[model samples]
Target: MAEVYQRLAEHLDRLPDGFAPSEDGAEIRLLKRLFTPEEAELAVHLTLDREEVGAIAARASLPEEEAKERLEEMAGKGLIFSAETEGGKVLYQAAPFVIGIYEFQVNRLSDGFLQDLNDYWSTVKERKEPKTINQLRTIPINESIDSRLEVLPYENVYALVEAHDRFAVAPCICRSRAKKLGKGCDAPIDTCLVFGDFADYYVRTGKGRHISKEEAKELLVKADEANLVLNPTNSMLVSAICCCCGCCCGILKSLKYASKPSEAVASSFIVEYDEPKCVGCLKCVERCQMEAVTADVGGVRLDKDRCIGCGLCVSTCPTGALNLVRKPDRGEKLPETFFDTWRAIAKQRDAA
Candidate 1:
């Protein structure tokens, strides 16, 4: 049984966003926590690409009815992915451990499960193939950008949400896990917002509730006011938005330890401070989740590399000294649609 899960872990490691193997066998244990022996065997045959049950069963060499039942059951448990198409055909697929299956377990995650996941995460530092597409990217607070710079629809949180008719909110899984480990902060827990097909998956799987577009915009404002980092999907179509904090978000916390944190995720802007207007009040320093701001000899200095262009510091500046400028090199190119972005990443993985 244990060997089955070990095989399952190895299978997951081959996906686009890999589940790298661990020396301590923690990966296998994490798999066991999420999958039964039979489930592990079945899951090993699945792929990250979505397919109808007949196709999935053909790949697994099982009857369509039998595979459909098991796959639907796994989807119900938040262990696999399932979705209904425009034509009403059901599709099943495997999902990565993080940013996928683990996130889907928002409503039902156990403390023990989180501990095992954290342990597994701690061990997975090195990998053979780096991801071509960042799982998340920083989006500036819509209201905090400099009035002069032209903000794109994708860069504005409210504009992105307005494009989606269906919306859903789930607990911030990182904060939930941190709370379980007694390392969490008072930052709001239920601020993860999803849209379109992603939103449908969350609500259909019973992990989240449907929310109005107005409610979604309000949540974005509330999160910005709370000094949370706004991270959305790395695509322009904006399938999801995560209200993150430095204290609990895996992405933000990891940036603190990264040798070159700026390269860890994509950002369209960087902070620029006006020295003459600076008061050294240190409000920006307090609000900056990236540790990019600090008191300098004359005023506050901004670490352009450390700043992810979240605009939280701009909102906190009483002196009106800080503003976000478009990062010309990286900001110029963005995928026009979510699927276009995903396909680009998939192509890189295939080439590798």
Candidate 2:
């Protein structure tokens, strides 16, 4: 196995556009456990809808039976499978970590990338300052799905803007991601919230504005040149933005510098903790991306000032120890903004 791995390593004299093939990293470690070196190598080579036997022949020059057998063996290991709808054909892909490793160069970052990005975060993005949804103007971010999600901002010092979009359907790709401790990331922006349909997002709901399809394409090109990855799913262009905590959506596990939500992203809302019913199980603390909870030999503590008021930590509590309270000054109640925007846009877009 080591010999095969070494042999392949020598072949990768250079990486693809901003991409590294595979090696011993968190992602590669995951793939290595799931596949043999030969299979893994082939896994990277197979195109999305390409045939399994042809892909192996192209990469390994193996005979049909051998390649087919190997592909089936991998299928047994869940390494390969036949597509049901798109192609009803055998195709192979690298394992999760292998794909993640493939994403790493673009998703995660190295040390030098992090330093340069941090510089951009503080100087250019200005994410640490509190923000208002009415004033936010940039790309138009929209989502199709209404389940839990997070939209990380790019202007804050942290370079990760934790947000969620509440829409449920999408016509493009599946998901977007944030800068995971690396290069080519948007400067983290202060977190903000979006609600209603697309209208309120540009007005009172969130920081970003709706983008034209052409503009959205331009943004993707811009991110490409900077080596940044947007929602591969492109849901942002289809849905509204949300502020969420770690206990719920996938992003905003933590703010980069502050243990709690930054002053900028903190909700115009707050979460109150009832110590009398609190069991001190550390669940809230674990789920609070804001780190608003603390203990000092007494019981769990909720720092009202630190809570962004996404109300996530409260949802998971066992003893009914928490609840979310709206902050009157935090953001605007823009239901009219939503109706006006959606109506106007629908009128214009549909009329056209």
Candidate 3:
């Protein structure tokens, strides 16, 4: 059983997000908690691409019916990824640890599981490697951008919402984990949004409820009002958007440790402060998740490097002292779609 889990860990480590081994073997412990020996063995044979039941069964050397049942069970347990086509054909695939397995466990977390994850993440943080691709990218709220500036379709939160037909709202996994540990904020818990096929999967697995496009837009507005940062999957074809808070979100909290949060995140814009129009109300200071705005003797100070261009400060500023501007050197173009994003990450990891 332990050997099977070890093999599964190595398989996951090869993924783009990476399930790195730890000195304490916490990663293996996490896998033990999540997968049975049989499931782990089957998972090792799976690839990133989705496959039909017969194809997967042949690859695993299992009977077609047995493989189908096992795949369905693993998918329900959030141990792997599965999708049903319009013609009612089912497909199964491997999922990475971060954006896939961990996020899928939103509705099924326990105290023991949380502790194991924390232990694993502690080592992961120390051994972090520089990557060219981020799984998620930051985008300012609709009200934060200047009307005159040209915002790409992917950069516009409203446009992204409008592009999707199907939507689902799920509990923010980070906030759920925080609340379970008794250390989260008062922000709304059900702010995570999934779209299209991801939405179908979430709804099928009972992790989230189906919501209409209008409802999704309304939720985005509410999240904005609550001062949550909007981070969507880093692809032109958005699949999900996480409305995150600094107190609970792992990505936002990691920014606190970064010397330059702006450079650490993928964002097209940065906050530009107009010193002359400033007021001492300190609204921006309270709204900033990155701690980029602080009270100063004159008014409030804006730290450009610390900002992630969330636009929370700009949306609520009394005197319009803050505005978002496009970065002069916005790096490489975003991946065309979600699969493309992961493919690029996998290629980069392979080269590294």
Best-performing candidate as measured by TM-score:
3
Every candidate's lDDT:
0.81, 0.38, 0.90
Best first by lDDT, ranked: 3, 1, 2
TM-score for candidate 2, residues paired by index: 0.33
Q: Estimate, for each residue in 241-323, the C-alpha lDDT of model 1 and write its tens digit.
A: 99999988877887777765766667878889899999888889889988888888978887787878889988878888998
* Each prediction's TM-score versus the true structure: 0.93, 0.33, 0.97
Prediction-by-prediction clash tally: 0, 40, 0
Which window of ten consecutive residues has the lowest lDDT sum in model 3? Answer: 123-132
Cα lDDT of candidate 3 equals 0.90
Candidate 3 lDDT, 68-119, residue by residue in tens: 9999999988988888999999898888888889999998898889999998
Identify the superior model by lDDT, candidate 2 or candidate 3. Answer: 3
Q: List the residue pairs that clash in candidate 3.
A: none
Q: Which stretches of candidate 2 lie over 4 Å from their true place?
A: 1-119, 122-131, 134-238, 242-263, 266-268, 329-352
lDDT per residue (tens digit) for residues 1-352 in model 2:
5554443333221111112233223223333444588776555554323355776676777777777777766544444333222345545533222212222222223455444433432343222322232211122122211124332332111121133323221111011233333212232222222222322312321223444334333443333232221222112222333322243222343332445453534233366777788877776775655567776455687776566554445656777777654445533332232223233333333343
